[model samples]
Every structure is written in structure tokens, then in C-alpha cells.
Target: MKKLLKNIKLVLFFAGLVLVVFLANCGLTPLTIEVPSVVNANEVATFILNCGTEPRIANTDPPYTSKLIVGFMVPKSWKAAQNTTVELISSEKGNSTLVLIPSAEKEAASGLAWPDAAKKRFGIGPNLLDDFEWLVYRSVPAYTFINNEDIKFKVKISSKVGSENSFSRLGFFILSAKENLRPEDTDYTKYAFSNNFSVTNGEGDLVDYVNPQLAKVEPVKSLDNDFISLNFDAGIIETTLSNTDEIFLEARGFTKSGQQIAITTKVDKTRLKPLGGKKYRIDIWPRGLLNVPQNETLDRFEYYFTNAAGNAKVGYGNTADPFRYTFKCP
Candidate 1:
């Protein structure tokens, strides 16, 4: 009976030790986010990352804090520049995963593969990020418990920035909890928090370049119809700079068979005529130019702008704003 009592006490002591270790392994860290209002294709947005007021033991041993990687998505029509730049704002102490993708078409050709889970989480596909490519830059290791309020570093964008038209510049503040951090434990109670920022110099209307008004597409009855039509208000950002050359428009169609038809040619910019202060519309149709088959599930459409110099930009285009009530024809 006495031996049984000793065994019970030992078991209880070990259990308590395990609990203490678990508590020590897991903690919390706060992360605040402040994204820029706008980022130009070729311009860089400077940012600051400061760890706020929080006092806790940072994981110093094998299991360190989480690692963060940043990313962005460019629009399809953007032409890749010769030299793209990405400058870090904070301490350039750690390694990052910065890469440049030429076009969504290059993904399949790049021979890159990922688990289904990561693919779905990041919305990886040919078109979702089709027209654009990617750029990645890796940073070195950094372990600074920034608990004070101060501005960080100034990261620069690529010199080969895509033209504002073709590139839909995006910023991603990515975090990976699995790196060096405790896997079995879920809570991060002892970490600090930070709010990121990007600097912007000016503001302009979406109409400055194209018509600020909405764009329309004349819907067709059959998917196999060889012709497609679209209409939209023009956008012109600069009034004084009237090199008013030719404007080009392009059409893309996503079919039910998981196929997309992109335009070999662009629309005309001169078609834009002012309706009011910043309102105008243009009608577009690829009659003999485009050969689109009649398919029942004609999903979406997009319109972009380009000048005679071949400079391009993407305006607004939609799938829900139907120009015609689609019906089957016997």
C-alpha cells in the first residue's frame, strides 16, 4: 500500500512538469497591418514595421518565432520591365523569398508544384493571376524584439515596374507559424505586435486615364458565337498631357471547359467621347477579328486600355452586368 502511494505521487509530479514545459513553449504575439492606399506599377511604397509595447520571452532556442514572407500579384496585361526593384524598409537582416513571375502562363512552364492545400489557400491558378507574373526577394535572418515605436527601413520597387495599365500591383504580408516555432502548441502569448505602412505621394481619380464611368459588354445568346461586344466609359488621368494617340481595348472570355480566350489585338482609345464631367462610353466588337466558339457557359469579360505607343492599363470590366438576356437558340 505504501509503494502504491509513492507511485501515484511520482506520476502527478511528472504530469505537472509536462504542463509547465508546454506553457513555456507557447505564447502570443500581436501583428498590426497598415497597407498603402495605392502602389504604382514602377514605383516603390516605403513601409515601417515596429513591434509595439509587449514584454515576453522570445523563443531563443531551436523553436524561434514565426517567419514572414511578403508577396504580390500583377495584372496580366502588364509588360515586364527590364529591372524590377523591391527594397525592404526595416532591418535587412533576415532572408526572404522574393521572386518575379513573368506571366501566369509561366507557372506551368516553371515546373513548380504545390500541395493542393497551399494552392487553394493562395488562390493559385492560370487566370486568377493570369495576365501577370511574380517577383520574389529573400531577406536574411532577423531576430529583433521591437517593443518601441519607431519607423523601419525603406524598401524600393522594381525599376522594371510594369506599366500601370497591365500590372495590378498587390502587397502581401505573409506569415508562417510553422517555422522554428512550436508546432504542438497553438498559442503565441509572449510575442509582440506591429502595424506595417507604405508611403504614397499623390492621389488621382480612376478616371484620369480611362473614363471613370462603368464599362458594358453586349451579351450574346450562344457560346459558340464568333463575335463579342463590349462598352465602357473612358478614363483619362492627365488632361494637359494630350498626346491623345490611339487607345486600344482587349477582350478575354472564360469558358465552362476551363478555357480562356484572350485578344490578340486591343480596342481603340479614340472611341472615347465625353458624356459629362468624367463620363463617357465606347462600344466594342471583335467581328471578323476574333473567332470565339458558341459555348453555353460564357463566364467573364475584362477590358484594358493602351496608347499608340503601346502603353497599356486595365480599367473595370464585369461579368454580372449583362448587356442582353441570354437564352438558348434552337
Candidate 2:
């Protein structure tokens, strides 16, 4: 009996050590959910879901692993659909209508080439504004099918007003996939596939950096020039550090017909010496009229300047200001 007890103790000790190492390793790896970058308005942005460091057995009996399910979040103003369309009416008592029907061949050409419709049956067309959802459960197979695969969808914009004033607001959605889940999973009982996304009107993703706010925008002069001299500042609230971070400043004319130009964007922080106590000055113009546009029809000009200093891995949000200049058409 004494020998048997010693053997049991040895087995338990070794098992505990193995379990601890496994858990510790899992915690050290970074897990992330990244949405695709090319998604446009009225388009479906596919999601890349990664399980933790390694796939672990989520269920013991049937032998299941972690997988993802997606959900959609849309603007309150829009709905999903089979095909999207618009009706155009002019004040001149003339009206025209356009219809959109889904075509596998047509949709496939939107991006890089797609596989010649495998044996899988193609899904039917969706209403342009109809909000409908379905699921692709048993994600191990689904994941394998879509591994490195990009899913595509479209958004349709129409105008009752002329196309000039008619515009569409694109939406950003959050996609969540249930993983490390169990048959009796109750923690996320209300969870579903990717569906919840916020909406916006712009050229970039719907992910808006809200908290690390832009406190102020200013134009300061740091030098005397024969042409135009300008400086700008931006105040950033508390934030983290990030990679591929760029300071984006944009100047737009009220009229699309007006010409707008951008000067060189690269600014060296080391050269940007400190000004006042909490402020720093960046050289906006070396000399001349800047990289101003040729046309004098510009109604407005704006700029965004960004740089990365200190710890960049975590992303930092510092304050900044923009400089601008306006001139009469020659």
C-alpha cells in the first residue's frame, strides 16, 4: 500500500507541472481580431479570426475546438438586401430607375481572381437594402475553406436627389466569433456571429479613434519667408502606441471642381524642437507658397501632421496642430 501511494503522488505532481506550463504559455501569446482593410461602403468586410496560441480541445467527448462565428452591425438608416438599386428623378419631370442583380462572375471580378466556383453551390443574390443574416457553423471546416480567403460583399448607393447631392453613408461593423466554446456554453449566451458594425461617411474603415481625441488645431509661424511660412500643432489626449501610424492632415475645397494640393508630409521629430512648456513646433513651410494648388478656387485648406516618438509598440496619442493658407485667384 505504501509503494502504491508513492507512485500515485509522483504521477499527480508531474501532471500538475505540465498543466501549469500549458496555461502559462497560452496566456503569453497575443490573440487578435482583425477586419479586412479593403472593405468599402455597401461592402462586406471579411474577418480574420485566430484562435489562441495553439488549438486546444474545447470539448472532450465529441472532440471540438475553438472556432469563430460572425455578426453584423449596420447603420440605423440602412438595411440588407438581395440586390441594391436606386430611382433617379429630376425636377424636369423625368424619372429613371436602376436595378442591381447579383452575378457570380461579376462579383468575382471586384478583387483578385476567385476560384472557378468549386463544386459548392453559389448562394442567391441578396436585396440591396434588405437586412438578412445566416450562419456557417462547424467552423473548423469553414475556417479551412476560408483560410487566407477573402469574403466579398457590396453596398449600393442611390439618389432620389440628383447624383450630385445623393450620397450613401457606409457602416462599420464588429464581428465576433465564438471560440473555446462548449456545447453547454452559457457565458456568452447572447453572442452570435459577426453583425454589429458602426456606420460612417468616409474613405477609411469605420474604426474611429475616439478617446485619444484631437484637442486643438492651430497654425503658428516659425520663420520669415518671401512666400508663405506656417506651423501647426495637434494636442492628443492619453493613448497607446501603434505601428504604421501616420499623422494624417487633409485639406479639401468646398467644390470638387477646385484644385487641392498637398506638400511633402514627412516631418522629423528630432528637428521639431520644443517651443513652450507643453508645446512643440513643426515646420509647415520651408518657403514659398507651399505645395499650393495651381487653381485659386480653393475655399478651404487643412493639414494633419503625425509622428512616432518614445515607445511606439503600444501607440501614443500626442497633441498636434494644422497650418493653412488662402490666397486670391491670380
Candidate 3:
């Protein structure tokens, strides 16, 4: 009787161990997220996610079928830029998938293999198998809320497992612009000057003269922040007054509450050159330049030009109509 009882207990123990291993292999493991404890609303933010074990990639036909999804939640009053979708591919030998190209096309083009294509796409070194882990970088543009209060941002990650789904939360982190000390005077008034002064030649006529004209105004969508690029016609300014006169682009950003933010003289070094004959483009990054009020949306941007000579023109000609760029601010 004692020997029979011991045998029964041994059998039960083995069964329980097998059951635990099966459950672990079939179950989903939560991913660990690493992010900054505090983030600046005026700068780009990044997050990294780590998985302990190889995530199961459903053997789907399409390579681009999203295996992992990430989302961000901000305050109702605050706005966030568009979300980026990252598709995770299997890195296992022979099981590696190339989602960049369709399977049909892939099979048709027989000369190059899928592994070669993946190597090129991922910029993997020669010893690809040695590097088992893959890292993806995602950036979110900076944004500020209305009030000085701290704001929490939530990040969520989900993965599809067979017919069900596994989810993980990254929790929340505080984002604020005021937490970090900023320049007190963010207005561009100091850079604002008169546009009445001009230069003349020995003939006392407008010779070799150039008046700044608004050529093109467009929004630059980027991971840093939504910025405005202003192109100006510097006609002969490059050769004529390139050394003496300083050209400045002025822009006024208005909030829904009627508060005004401006970018006057601050110019990026890269955009401080003449594109061609009298063509200059100035890109305005609003992070530190445009002081947006918390919660209020920037509805429109009014742009003009000024120079050391104070004779810069606003539009194409003297009688040109008023121009402004409108956007759905977030």
C-alpha cells in the first residue's frame, strides 16, 4: 500500500510540472518598457520596449500584417502627433519573414533571397544570427498643454496571439515645459524693427536693390514639432547687400485665446543660406521660439519680413493682399 501511494504521488508531480511548462510556453509575457521619468513638452520623446522571450509571430501570409501595436494617450486638452506603426518580423532561421516585399513578388524574383533583402533593410552586419535582438526607435513630436500643471501620458502595447490578444501598459509619465527653466522673454519683439529704411546707388535711384518678398509658406511635419518654413525672394540681395544688410523673417502665431507668439530673428544655421537667385528659406522650430499658451490652440500664423535696412517687403509686391497660414493645432 505504501509503495502504491508513493508511485501515485510521483505520477501527479510529473503531470503538474508538465502542465506548468505547457502553460508557460503557450502564455503571453508582458513586455518591459523603458522611458524617461520626465519628458520635455518641447522636445521629441522616445520609448524602448524589451521582450524577455521571442514573441510568437502568427504565420500570416502577409509580412506587413501588424504583429505589435503601440498607442499613446494624452489629456483631452492636449494634442499629440500622429502615431507610428511598427511591424515586428520573425528573426528565427528559415522562419525569418521579409514584410517589405510581397510574397508573390518575392517568389517571382528568384535571383535574390528574402534573407538578403532583410539584411539590406535592417542594415544587419555579416554575422546576423549573433545579434538576436532587434531594436526599433520611434519618436513623438513635442507638445505642451494649457496650464502649468503636470500632464500624464499613457503608452500601451498590444500583441496578437492566435485568436486572442496580449496587452501591456507602460503607465504614465509627467510632461511639462515649465518644469525646466526657460527664457523669460520668448516674444520676438526685440528682433522686430522698422522696415522703412533702404539703400540707393550713386544715381540716387533703387539700383541693385532687393525687397524681401514672401515666396512660399508651408508647414513642416516632423518628429520634433510642427514647424513653418518661410521662403523669401532675396532678389539680388545675395550679391548686392549680402554683407551689409541682415535679413530677418518675422512670424506671429496666435492662440485661440488671442495670445500671440512670435519667431523673429532666430534662424537655423542650415536654412540661413540662399537657395538660388534671391531665394531664401527659413524654417521656424517653435519649441523655444513660439511660446504657446497651455491648452489653447494655435489657429493661424502671420508672417512678414524685416531687415537691418528696415525696407523689407511683406508679400510679392507692395499692394499684395494679406496672407496667413491656417492649421488644426494640437
Q: What lDDT score belongs to each candidate, Candidate 1 first?
A: 0.37, 0.30, 0.36
Model 2 lDDT per residue over 1-330, tens place: 999999999999999988776444321123233343333354443444332223222234643223232222222223333322323222321334323222232213223111111101111122122122221222222222112122221211221111111122222111113322222322321222222233334432222212222322222112212223222223333333222234322332232366545543344521334444333434433222244444433344544444443322111134233433333211
Candidate 2 lDDT at 57 equals 29
- Candidate 3 Cα outliers beyond 4 Å, as residue runs: 1-213, 220-224, 235-245, 263-272, 316-322
Candidate 3 to truth, TM: 0.30
List where candidate 1 sits over 4 angstroms from the true fold: 1-35, 38-42, 47-68, 77-83, 87-119, 124-134, 140-161, 166-169, 176-330
On a 0 to 100 scale, what is the lDDT of residue 255 in model 2? Answer: 24
lDDT (tens digit, per residue) of candidate 1 on 30-63:
3333445455645644433322222133444552
Q: Highest lDDT: which candidate? A: 1
lDDT of 3 by residue, 1-330 (tens): 999999999999999987666444421234345554333232333544433222222332332111222222221111222222232222321112112222223311224333232223333222211111122222232222221222222232221111111111122111121221112221100111111212111111121112333454443212214765666665633333344335565667777778887765535532345677656767766443576655766766666555544354353333333345555322
Ranked by lDDT, the better of candidates 2 and 3 is 3
The CA lDDT at 179 in model 2 is 29
| Candidates ranked, most accurate by lDDT first | 1, 3, 2
Model 1 alpha-carbon miss at residue 218, Å: 14
Poorly placed runs, candidate 2 (over 4 Å): 1-11, 22-30, 36-40, 52-62, 65-68, 71-209, 212-330
* Each model's Cα RMSD: 15.4, 19.3, 25.0
Q: Which candidate is the best by TM-score?
A: 1
